[model samples]
Target chain A: MEAKNSAKERMVQSALELFHQRGIRGASVDEILKRSRAGKGQFSHYFKNKDGLVLAVVDYLEAIIRSGQVDSNYSFSSWDDFEGWFGRYIGFQKEVDCELSCPLGTIGNDLTNDQDHLRRAVKSFFDWSTAQLARFFAERKAAGELVESADPDALADLCMVVMEGGMLMSKITRSTALFERAADQVLSYIRSLR
Target chain B: MEAKNSAKERMVQSALELFHQRGIRGASVDEILKRSRAGKGQFSHYFKNKDGLVLAVVDYLEAIIRSGQVDSNYSFSSWDDFEGWFGRYIGFQKEVDCELSCPLGTIGNDLTNDQDHLRRAVKSFFDWSTAQLARFFAERKAAGELVESADPDALADLCMVVMEGGMLMSKITRSTALFERAADQVLSYIRSLR
Candidate 1:
């Protein structure tokens, strides 16, 4: 039983990496199994199929966010953290050479309507991410740091849109020009609300 | 010669429809040919290969935008046109049932790094879209309708990001909730600038 769980964990991790690098559809099931070092029997016994594995991959991603490891690190507790978080995106595009996009977004965009279950899995990550940002705004408003009329949900959603959209542009252009400009404007706009 | 041109147009139009409905990779060459009712001779006689067809499709999509047949309808000459343009996105997500994303972005996201040429074709559309919006913002600043502090390029890119980002979320959640909130917030933010 322990070995079985280990194989499943390995498969999920491998899928996550491959999906990020090659896109969700670009990675085949056999390649995933090979990378996991797991046999066909083990995969069938564990995931049942590729869709099941994709769902697990998404769940793992959510765990990463919940752990407050990356963007969620800011928690929007302070303006400094907000700037730090947004700045990281600029650094991130350069680090990745503007080749990759948001893991969640890349998956979401790769999926089709027939892949509804997979799309929903991606949405869960977006929802969780937005909630973290919204909590910060709500807290700020409660403390009068933000204006009374400031819409936390809308603000949070805007932040997500800006980041996702900017990331998409960066990936397409192979340059962070659009993302850099977008980040500057969005940061200033958000600052004005305070 | 005219007959050959007719066949070429049919192939491109069919490719556009198929790519939009089934995704870039999902639509095979044979399927596109079958849908076009054109023979294999016509395929090679025109595009030469699938990548060629993809480039043509990207150009076709750009033409659609330039014709102001869709979102470019607003041209963003005035604030009312800006609001109308953004509003159309909300309506669009509903019309497509949040299943399809920005045609330009969908192609960009689906492409891998090796497909840089295709990515650039998609980028041209983005560049054009940004220029149209930037022109609007620039006009506003010149007319003293907007603050002197406003950066026209940044504002235009922000608009692109919001729309692209909102379309992505709508596609993921299979609902327009995130998009509606984002559009409302972004619209209000821009309004405050004037």
Candidate 2:
């Protein structure tokens, strides 16, 4: 059982890295298996195919987001908290030389319209992340940290849109200027609500 | 010459359609040839290869934007103009059932990180689009329709970010709600500038 789980983990990890670097179709099943050092049978045993592996990658990414691996220390307790979180995120983008695309965004964009299963997985991940942020804002509102007029759900959705958009533009431009503009605008909107 | 141009056009049209439907890597060269009804040799005759074909598609999309084929009537002359343009855009989204991802955005996202030629092509499309909008905003500011504090370039960047971001979210959720939120915020920001 232990060996099985580790092999599965290895495949998922390898798939995630290759997919990020080469995109979904660019990364092949054979390459993933070779990189993971897992036998060919292990891949078939763990995943139905490349598409199935992609779904697993989505779930893995969701787990990472949920576990706070992206930004473990930040809490949405105050305005400062939000700024700190965004600052770190932008800083991390710089740390990686702006080559890092959002794992979810990259996967989501690479999927074809016929890829209903993968699309749903990506959608669920975004919905889950958005809902988590919404809940945080709702809590802040309940505690009077946010203004009465601020709709937590709407705000959360806006933040996600801007962040994703910003990331896409940043990746294309190879500069963080677009993202900073987006972050500034979102921060101002949040501040206005306060 | 006419026959050659038409054949080239057919291939570009077919490639654009297939790439949008199946993604870049998902669309095969043989499929593009079959759909275009062009001789297999025509592809090499017109384009160096699939990557060259993708560059042509980028140029085609850029031409569409430049020609104002997407939304030609509404000029960004005032706040109401912005709203009208966005309204038509959202209406088009509904007309297409929200499956119409930004052609440039979709292709740009699917490219591998190492695809410098394709990446540069996508970046040029974005820069051209942003510059066109920036010129519009500059006109508005010159005509006193927008506030003096408004920077046309920055405003244009924000609009593009929100728009591409909104399209992505809308595509994922399979709902127009996220797009509406993004459009609303962007409109509000533009309005505030006036």
Candidate 3:
């Protein structure tokens, strides 16, 4: 059981990295297999095919967000906490030279129209992430850190859209200027509510 | 001359439609040939290859924007002008069931990282569009219709980011709700500036 789980984990990690560097279609099953050093049978055993592995990659990305690996030092108690989170998030983009986009988004955009299973997986990830953010806002509201006029669900949705959109633009322009501008505006909106 | 122009136009038009519906990788030269009813030699004569055709598609999309074919009925004189534009834009998304994203965005995102020539083409298109928008905002400010505190260039950048970002989210969630929300917030910010 331990060996099985390790092999599965290795495949998922390899898929995630390749998918980010080269897009979904650009990265092939063979490349993923070679990178993971798993046998051909191992890939089929772990994931039925490339599509199955792609779905696993989505879950892998979601886990990274939930684990706070990206923003390990930030909390969500106040507006400032959220600002800190954004700072680290965009800072990481700059650190990577703004070459890669949000992994879920890159994969989702490529597959959303044609792959129903993949689309559903991407939607669930967004729904789950948005709910997590909404809960944070709700908690802040309950703690009197946010204004009464702020709607947790709407704010959460707004943040998700801006971040996804900003990241898309950043990737195309090969610059973080648009991302930072959008982030600043969203941050300003949050500040107004406070 | 007219026959040659028409044939070339047919290829570009066919490519635009296929790329939007099926994505860059999903569409093939033969498929485009069949759709356009152009001879196989016609594609090569007009465009060296699929990559060359993709670049032509970018130019075709840019022309649609510049020609005002999409926004022919609307004008950009004041804040209301911008609102009307957004309403029509989002409404069109609903009309199309939100399946297609900005054509330039879709193509640009796919080719940005690996294809330097395509990336530059996409960037130039964005720069032109953003500059056009900035000019509109500048006109409003000069007319004393917008607040003096508003930066036309920054506001234009903000608008592009939100729209692009919002459209991306809408495409992923398969709904226009997020797109509308992001647009409304950006509009409100513009209104606040006024």
Candidate 4:
């Protein structure tokens, strides 16, 4: 059982890495298999096909995004933390080499005409992101730091849109400068509410 | 000469429609030739290959974006006009059924590992977009309608990011409603500034 779980975990990690580097359609089963160091038999045993693997990867990504990141723990507690957290997030991407694309943004763009399951997976990820942001704003209001009319849900949605777009531009331009600038603006706007 | 120009224009229009529907890499030369109704020889005569065709399409898209849609003919003289113009610009994709994909966004996310020329083409399109938005904001500021402290360049960058991400979500969820909601938030923010 432990071995099986380990193999599955390895497959998910390999898929995430490959999917980030090469797009959903571009990353092949052989590549995933090779990266995971699993044989064809092992791969086939785990996943029905490429689509199944994609499903697994989507779930894995969504889990990580929804599990923490923007939860009450590391997000929107104060203006400084809000800006600092996001700044560090963007900065972390630059530090790691700008080649690491935003997995959700990249996949979300490519999976538009794809299968329904893929579409749902991407949507769920964004929905969760928006929800988390809304919670952050709600907390700010509860703390009396935000105006009653601030509209946390809407603001969160707007912030997500800019973030996704900024990351998309950064990936395309190979420049973190634009992302950093945009993130700064967002953080500033958030700070203004206080 | 007129006939040749019309044919080329049709080819470009057809390519944009098809490319948005079926991605640049996913769509084939044969598909483009079929959609454009141009002969094999004619396509080759016009472009070196698929990459060349993409370049033509990008140029065409850039010209269309910079033309009447922007420029001085439209008055962003008031907050309403500013929000309305920007909203319409981003939201028109729903009408054409190209809701989720920015031709440049799609290409940028897909071609992260592409060669220099392709990357440069994507960068140029975004640079033009950023510059145009900045110009619009500059005009708004010049009229003294915008906040003096407002950074036109930063706002433009943020607008670009939000619209791109909004499109991604709208496409992923297979719902045009996401863009409207996201745009409403943006429009509200613009209004709040005034």
Candidate with top DockQ is: 1
User: What interface RMSD does each of the candidate structures achieve?
Assistant: 1.5, 1.7, 1.7, 2.0
Fraction of the reference Cα-Cα interface contacts (below 8 Å) that each candidate reproduces: 0.67, 0.53, 0.55, 0.61
Clashes (N, CA, C under 3 Å) per candidate: 0, 0, 1, 2
Error of 3 at B84 (Å): 2.1
User: How well is each residue in B48-111 modelled by candidate 3, as lDDT tens digits?
Assistant: 8889999999987877877778752234766667787667767767887888777777787777
Q: Runs in model 3 with CA error above 4 Å?
A: A72-75, A112-114, A143-148, B72-75
lDDT of all predictions = 0.82, 0.78, 0.78, 0.71
Q: Is candidate 2 or candidate 4 better by DockQ?
A: 2
What is the C-alpha lDDT profile of model 1 across B131-179, one tens digit per residue? Answer: 9999999998899888878889988888888888888888878888887
Question: Per-residue error at A34 for model 3, in Å?
Answer: 2.0
- After the best TM-score superposition of candidate 1, give how far the Cα of residue A117 lies from its true spot, in angstroms: 2.2
Ranking of all predicted structures according to lDDT, beginning with the best and ending with the worst: 1, 3, 2, 4
Of 1 and 3, the candidate ahead on DockQ is 1
- After aligning candidate 4 to the native by TM-score, how far in Å is the CA of B66 from where it should be? 1.9
lDDT of 4 by residue, A143-179 (tens): 9988776778777776777677667777777887777
Q: What share of the true interface contacts does candidate 2 keep?
A: 0.53
Error in Å for residue A87 of model 3: 2.2
User: In model 2 chain B, which range of ten residues has the least summed lDDT?
Assistant: B72-81
Pairs with steric clashes in candidate 3? A165-B165
Q: If the candidates were sorted by their DockQ against the true structure, best first, what order would they fall in?
A: 1, 3, 2, 4
Model 2: clashing residue pairs? none
**Candidate 1 CAPRI level:** medium
